[model samples]
Structure formats: C-alpha cells, structure tokens
Target: MNLRTLILLLIMVAIAALAVLNWPLLATPTTMSLGLTTVQAPLGLIMLALTALMAAMFLAYVLGLHGSVLLEARRHAKEMTAQRELADKAEASRFTELRSFLDVQHSAMLARMDALEARMSNRLKESDNSTAAYVGQLEDQLQRQGGSGSGGVQELRIEPGLRP
Candidate 1:
C-alpha cells in the first residue's frame, strides 16, 4: 500500500510483538498498593489493556479528524465549482449583451451613412442644375451680343453682372 499505511502497519506489528513478548509477565498476578489498601492484579495485563484502549481512542480521533477534513474539502470544491459556473455564465451573458449592443450601433451607423449619401446625392443634383442654368444664361448673352456684330470679329467686354 502507500507509505503511511505501510508505516502504520509496521508500528502495529511491532506493538503486537512487544505485547506478545510480555505475555508471561502479563499472566502473573501481582500486588498493587493503594492509599489505604492493597489489591492483587495482573499489572502487565492491565498496562497492556490500558495502552490498547488509549491507542484505539487516539486512532478513532485521528480517523474522525481526517473524515471531517475530507468532507470539508469536498464541500469547498463543490462551492468553487458552482461559483465558477456562475462566473462563466455571467461572462457569457455580458458578451451576448455586448454583441447585441454593437449590432444595434452598427445598424444605426449604416443608416446614418445611407442618409448622408442621400443628402450628398441631392446636393450634387442641385449643384448640377444650377450650373446648367448658368451655362444657358451665358449662351443666351453671347448670342445677343453676337447678333449685333453680324458674324464679324468683335472685341469681347468683361462684365461682373453674375449674381444670385
């Protein structure tokens, strides 16, 4: 098995051997002194029994502590997993909301661009119409001036009469 189990097993085996070796002493009855009395007992046996009892109690305590630690660790792991899931969900939701917001902003920008293009187109058309009208007026003015010259070479005059 593992190192801990191996060491524990070796310690138990050594203690058992020690107990077995003292079996003869354990069987022999002896007198023990009290405050005001004396009693005949197997001191070795009593000592061994007390040692065994103490060992059992210590082992139980250690096992109980280990079990509590293991359960606490499991509980913490579960809470961490739940917290991680919640965080992941929150992050994903934020991403989804951000994407939706970007999409709406993108559509609004496109619509604004379309409106700007339409306005630019109308301005260009208006500019072209005004230019054509000016050109027609210039042609009529040239015709009227040339009509008086009868196709002869004439000196052109400069004028500043163009106004809106």
Candidate 2:
C-alpha cells in the first residue's frame, strides 16, 4: 500500500489499541458541560465515537469526490470522441473536393493536348501542299525552256522521292 495509507492504518490501529487498553477509564462516567445543559457521560468513549464519526464522514467525502471526477472524465471522453469524428469528416470532405478539382484539371489538360496535336497536324499538311506546288512549278519551267536547247541551258530535274 502507499505510505500515506499505511500511516493512516497504523494510526487507526494505535487508537483502537489505546481504547482497548484503557477500557475502564474510557467507561468511567464524567460530568460534561454543554452550552444549554450538563450531562454525566463516558467522556473518553464519547470522544472516541466522535472521532470515528468524523473519520467516516471524511471517507464518505473522499469517495464521493472520486466518483464525481470519474463521471466528469467520462463526459470529457465522449466530447473528445465527437470532436474527433467531426474533424475527420471535415478532412474527408477536403480530400473529396481536392480530388474533384484534380479530375477537372486533368480533363482540361488532355483537351488542350488534343487541340495542339490537331493544329500541328494541319500545319504539317499545309507545308506539304506548299512544297508540292513549288516543285510542280519548277518542273513546268524546265519543260518550257527545253524547247530552246541551243542556248546551252542545262536541264534541272528534282528527284520525286526527295522532300524539303
């Protein structure tokens, strides 16, 4: 047991031993004065009884205080549990909102990539068409100049398989 409890138990044992050892003296009647009257009683026994009553009262008070504290702690625990649940729900909502925002952003990014790809493809096609037109014009000029070969104009032939 704790030191304080052990000490209290020893003190109670000593008081009981003292009362038992002096039983005759404790039982001897003596006159005691009250505020309004006087009475002949065993003063030692009366004092012992009063001491026991006070001890019992103090013990009752201690037990009551301990019980009340336990109840308060239980209430606090319940409140803490509720608060924790609320915080968790709020966190989950934030996560859900974040997920939805990310989804929208991801979709927009994909759409932008697709549009850029389509524009790049259109530009490539236009460049190929322009290159073909230039090649065709060069061939036509070379064919017309070939009719006057006396001027020593060399024939220019572009390879069909080559691309700029």
Off by over 4 Å in 2: 1-3, 130-164
State, as a TM-score between 0 and 1, how close model 2 is to the true structure.
0.74
TM-score, prediction 1:
0.69
lDDT of 1 at 64: 100
Worst lDDT run of 10 residues, candidate 1, spans 155-164
Q: Write the per-residue lDDT of candidate 2 for residues 1-164, one digit (tens) a residue.
A: 99999999999999999999999999999999998999999999999999999999999999999999999999999999999999999999999999999999999999999999999999899788868877786878777787766677676765565454
Best by TM-score: 2
For model 2, state the Cα shift of residue 144 in Å.
Answer: 7.4
Best-fitting candidate, scored by lDDT: 2
| Backbone clash numbers for all candidates listed | 0, 0
TM-scores of all candidate predictions against the true structure: 0.69, 0.74
> Could you tell me how far off, in angstroms, the CA of residue 96 lies in candidate 2 after the best superposition?
1.2
